[model samples]
Target: MGHLWVIPAGPPLGSALVEKSEVVIRNFFLPFLFIRIGLLTDIFSIKDWKAFVSLGMILVAAYLGKVWGSLLSLIWFKTSTRNDLLFGCFLNIKGIIELLVFLRWIIYKPIDVQTFSTLVLFNLVLTAIVTPLISIFYKPRKRLDRISKIDNCIRTLQSTLPNSELRILCCIHHEDNVNGIINLLRASNPTEMNPICAYAVHLIDLVGRALPVIVPYNTQKRRLVANSTDRIMRAMTRYSKGSGAAVKVQPFKMISPYNTMHQSICKLVEDNLIPLVLLPFHENGEFQSRTACVQNFNKNVLSYAPCTVGIFVDRGLTYYHPSNICYNVAVFFLGGPDDREAMALVSRISSHPGMSITIFRIDLLENSVESENDRCLDDAVTKEFMVGNVGNTRVECHEMVANDSKQLMDAIKKEKDFELVIVDFAEGHMMSLLVIQSVESIKQGAKLLPP
Candidate 1:
């Protein structure tokens, strides 16, 4: 009745009461009851599986029957295969209520001591096993469908406006992340013709919470939504207002489980038809690495995001100052879809008057030529940039051959004056083996790499 009647009615007090009651029962009642049961049971009796085979068979039959029946009933709802399995696993649990019923049966002597012990053990083992299984197998089916639709919408938008407005989804962890993202956006150089539409999400980790909420953030009554008093939202609003009419920023606050927040971020990006997602590097500015959870979130987001993604490692972004700074950006083109995407991004940034870009196309002699088809795609993107972005004069391209790690290191060491170095993150799903080899070599020779 606590979970069923109280929660659905939408009263905060009722939910709080229920949660408190659950805590009391779990902490005060259950442990004492379990201790009593343990004191009564004989370990020697549990070892007599042959004698308790009749009771064991009944437990197996009951457990399997419930699981199969639950799965069959769920099929009518058109749920994904994962949900069906998770539902079945959940139904298999014989939890606190069942434990209480067995205790009453034992007290009334409706069951023998041996039978009671066997059933108690069965209940304990089944619940423990099913709890972990439910967590492991539960994949929210709606999230996947949402991602698919987002991909379709983004593809349509890109085809329609190839050289125009670049829609970007930016993720902000806290107030500290706000300046870094804003500076990077400023460096991207938004203009009146080819503008930037940014959607910023203030990611909040939901701890001891039952619901996930997405709230739009602003200086109005909207702040009441999702208990949001976000400093990041305020900062982003200021940045958008000061940046002129060319750049548009939409601020949102998202609350989700830290472990699975990447799914929510990806869904939002897809829904908004965002072409690029700008994420902060997992390492903080103070030379401290963030938590493992954050690092994994970045990795998972890259795998699930439908659009191009860039991890911004903010090195002060001093080049963005308009008065006297000339931003020099160097992109290492290792050859792949991600590499092409990085080059396209650099070209977009190069449109700004104060920014100059250099494209370093690294050629591995051993694995130089693949297929005509792949080569055509890479060549087409490069040719398109040259032909279309002709008004921007400060751009250069270079071809270099590096057969081994030593040569790759030597090649990278040549660029000493670049303010920003952009490299395609390799080891993605579609990355070729040759590209992986070169990426590894670059990673191994990181001291020669630029800041």
Candidate 2:
């Protein structure tokens, strides 16, 4: 009856209430109940040879029963052997409810004290070993690492085929992220010739649930919808419809623990052959407690992602647009594979009618030495971009030489106000530091100046 009511009544109880209830039950009730049960059970009662033989039989019978049942059920689904075995191990973990049933059977004289003790010991042993067993059999991180090596060869915009569909995985954290993501998608300028396939995943932290689930919006059966998720889905639908055949949106809700979420994401990317992933920047306000977890999640995604991972720092791209004005965008090219990827995306965004782009090719004067092969690759990409955008008034390219960090800062400041700025994630570069400082200064100047 409780399970039947959950479909219709679960959301009304509120996630907060459900989470608190789970915490109380897990941390307080279960431990206390287990202690009480331990006090009632006698380990010495099962010392006889007959009791020892019965205990051994029970352990074998229980484990084999669960494993055989799991294998039979999973064979029809064609799941992996490891998964089948893991599921069987999981089923062997008997919780408090099962212990209560055993106690009741003992009270009713249906099961002897030795049998009850053996069953309890069986449960304890299974529960203790299941986690380690699963860890040994199923290594998600290792699987992802293998996938990363295979995907690195082709999972990038620069390597994408010409006039082919662009697949992007967009991760949304909340309603605040919806508008920024939609705006970014629009700015990509999807068209009939170069269509986009967007997978918008709404990420929800796992709470009050034992297993994580990924639900597709169209296949969901629940009548009550989460407001934030509903809004995100509706916005994605609207964008898909408005873009006609240019954009195809597939929305999904992923409820998972942050610790293992990256594995799921990387798997999706590998399966779909997606070339890019867009993650929202972890904000430092309101949800401060979640910031660290989100930051860690982002780091893991970057580390394990099978494709290019972009952290979008949205600075009012959706709210600051004015009518009949071209959106100004600036791209800083520091000359690397990451920067080349940024340029590839910039080429796409520059196609938007309302966008005007300025490409700043910055070269350091002090440590200007680059490998001959690397310089040729950079020149090839830049030359291709310049040749393609030749005679296009909306696109402008500037070659600048910076002698030091201060000169880099001054060079960036000379550019006009831009609504969006794109930079590569090249570590250990002084240019990255200067760009960050310049962006902050720009934000301060914007606040100080009137609209």
Candidate 3:
């Protein structure tokens, strides 16, 4: 009955149900089973000298058989000697299946009491030592330590080389998120000279399964049970076809617990050398019920991600079809790394024929102190953007000065007419203040993109 639930035609089960079942089994049934087995086994049977010798022989034979058997099986595949040995060590661990078999054999008189005691002791001893043996034998490589400081700093739009493919990991939570994300992708200005490689990952909560899985869209034999994933895939496919080699998308479905979802995402980013990851804001109406889970996932991603992370708040961009309407984008730039990244992304968006970008460079008041290094970098990035888009009527730049959070809020309120507002969550500056205040002050029709 438990196995049948995994069938495609079976009734759907929620993650909560599986979680409750696991808790019950682990807390109640497993302990009872172990206690019953302990009561049935006789430790005195293995104390005799002859019994001790027989038990030692059985342990040696079982260890050799289990380890060598696994090693011999791996000869058909291409694997290193160390990995094969590690695999064998991992296979040495025995579990409830063996215990249940021992109980049945003892009840049916297939094995005597001495033999049963020897087998149970062998199982316990092997299981206990395998972990320490594995730890001693297998040492994993640290991928993060191998990454250079330059690589860490360059994983954003401002640092990407010219004519290079811009790789992005787009995380989709629901069908409603598809339209806003697709619009953003379209506004990225993919061209023959510079293409976009997008990895679309649909995150599903782990449910009704014993292990997590990441399934590729093209490899699945059956359609995904969730229609939301299918709809997102279809939308991405249509966009890919229409882009005519300017864009390529690889779709994946990652089913994992919320607590560990960010690890999978970060691993994907590291493996693919993705520069940017786009995430939906957790405060969206669709996510309100699971706000805490979604927020935790986003926070974990931000903390562990090796690249830049963008939190997108979709207001009404879903209604703005990229093919028909021109997108009015406003960028609020303050001097910092995050603001520079926002500017770099806006530079790309400004190149799209359907995009009109307004750059608002906000400066701190004379009374406020600024970091010289950060100010220099910000100026360099802004200068490069201006030089790149010289004489482009679609792009406009404005400069503003604000003394405090109130003035910054007023400045943002004046620009509420734009369809999209881009800001950076720059710490220890007016930018962060603006982000906190603008959440409520921004017009209802404007989308917000904060990195």
Better of 2 and 3 by TM-score: 2
Residue pairs that clash (backbone atoms under 3 angstroms), model 3: none
| Global lDDT of model 1 | 0.66
- Model 1, 1-451: lDDT tens digits are 2564424421244445655687887789889998887766655556666868988898899888876877785569776666666777777774667877887887889986777788887887887788888767665645554554433435422242645887878888766677767777787778778788889887766643567777787555554434333566677777778778768888887767657887888778766777777776565645344456566776667656666666665545563454344777777776766666666666667767777877787876655655777678778877777776676678888888899746876778765556667776534422111111122333432322122
Rank all candidate structures by their lDDT, best first, as comma-separated numbers: 2, 3, 1
Q: What TM-score against the true fold does each predicted structure earn?
A: 0.71, 0.81, 0.74
Whose TM-score is higher: candidate 1's or candidate 2's? 2
User: Which 10 residues in a row give candidate 2 its minimum summed lDDT?
Assistant: 429-438
Candidate 2 per-residue lDDT over residues 4-78, each given as its tens digit: 434321232445567668878888888898887787687788868686786788778978898889998665898
**Cα distance off (Å), candidate 2, residue 206:** 2.8
By summed lDDT, which 10 consecutive residues of candidate 1 come out lowest?
Answer: 430-439
Clashing pairs in 1: none
